[model samples]
Target: MAHLAACAPLGACTTKQNASLRSQSARVVPRAHHADGETQAASPALTRRGALAAGIAAASLVLDAQESGAVGFKKELKDKRRGRTRIPEEEYTKELQDGVKYVDLEEGTGEVVKKGTKVTAHYDAFFRGIDASSSRQARFLNENINLPEPYDFAAGSEIRISKSKELPLPPQALTIGVIGMKPGGKRMLLVPADPWGYGDKGYAEVPPGATIEVLIELLSIGEA
Candidate 1:
């Protein structure tokens, strides 16, 4: 600490409101001056006072004014994405007819389950027979359970209750029961009040004697 000060004059370095910012790389974006002195682009150095806001606005403008066709890229991609997991409307109609109930897995794609690979995902779950519409009363997480029993697969990989409840096997997870699913597939599971950890007593969030439903997606499995 003394070495740096000794190397320079006492007033050479001083603290200022923007002293911290001054030491760091400049985030300002310069504006381009056209023939009329109007801006075609923002100059980071000249953006002094409103640098942050100006940079953000400039970035937004740049992104907004991207190649005309680029704006439609998202819509186009969505159109194509509809084809990836796209269940035909006819299939949906068929499901509506059969009365078979299933929550169309959201963000259910992009899973390549082999023997062992790590994964992660979030799910919204609820018990069945609770009006069949909307009644999400409980949520649980970090229910890490290693599959194929007893074998350590990977660290930091997580499997939620909904996903774990489906499988028939286990090595003792926070909760028992998750749909045994393939790598990329997502599942919704319902844990009966009895089978769930709570033997007799129940709590506020979770009913004392009520079944619980969970939704989960296998994010990844470690390489074996």
Candidate 2:
């Protein structure tokens, strides 16, 4: 993405505005034409004034371009979200589907997850050991459960949820795997790497194609 200043041409200034800007520039930077056809040099003060005026014009253009870009970007995001294919709501069940194996530690009596529902949960993720051996260490990867307060999902915990518009969103292993879960439920999910657990592009300490275990405790569900 280009900076606002760099996208000034994208501002698309109107003809009237362009003419007005040219007139202002001409007034600030006067050129004296001699009878002998020699051009007289402008005064130092006038030169500085012209430069300042030009800078202000550029700044205004940058501001306009930035505002336009911001508005367009927001609209595009909204439209994209609207056009997205919504995942169908699943029937309430304890059975896990889509290659996601889960073990429910505590059953929830709250509302079940449906389309457009917003859910808040605290999770602890760990790199699963080979062959489910008791001797193998399941190294801790990340957690969002030890905070004093929740942010956007769990606030005031110094752990702010990222609103990044980047590619490859959070792992579907958790998002899709958590479908049909109700608030107050606790489940341990066994997530495979390909197309689920970071899709072969392992993040941070987790290696590529690594399997992971996520212990999730659902907090609340509300209207999105």
lDDT of 2 by residue, 116-204 (tens): 56666655455532122111122223331111222123211122335551211234555654567788887767767765565577765
Q: Estimate each model's TM-score.
A: 0.28, 0.41
Kindly report the root-mean-square deviation of model 2 from the true structure over all alpha carbons: 21.9
What pairs collide in candidate 2?
Answer: 150-154, 150-155, 151-154, 151-155
**Could you give the C-alpha RMSD of every candidate to the true structure, in order shown?**
19.4, 21.9
Q: What is the C-alpha lDDT of each candidate?
A: 0.38, 0.55
Tell me, by TM-score, which candidate is best.
2
Off by over 4 Å in 1: 1-119, 123-179
lDDT of 1 by residue, 82-187 (tens): 3223233233321211122233354344434432343333333332322221112122243322222212233223333346444322211111212233445555
Q: Quick one: best lDDT, which candidate?
A: 2
Model 2 worst lDDT run, 10 consecutive residues: 129-138
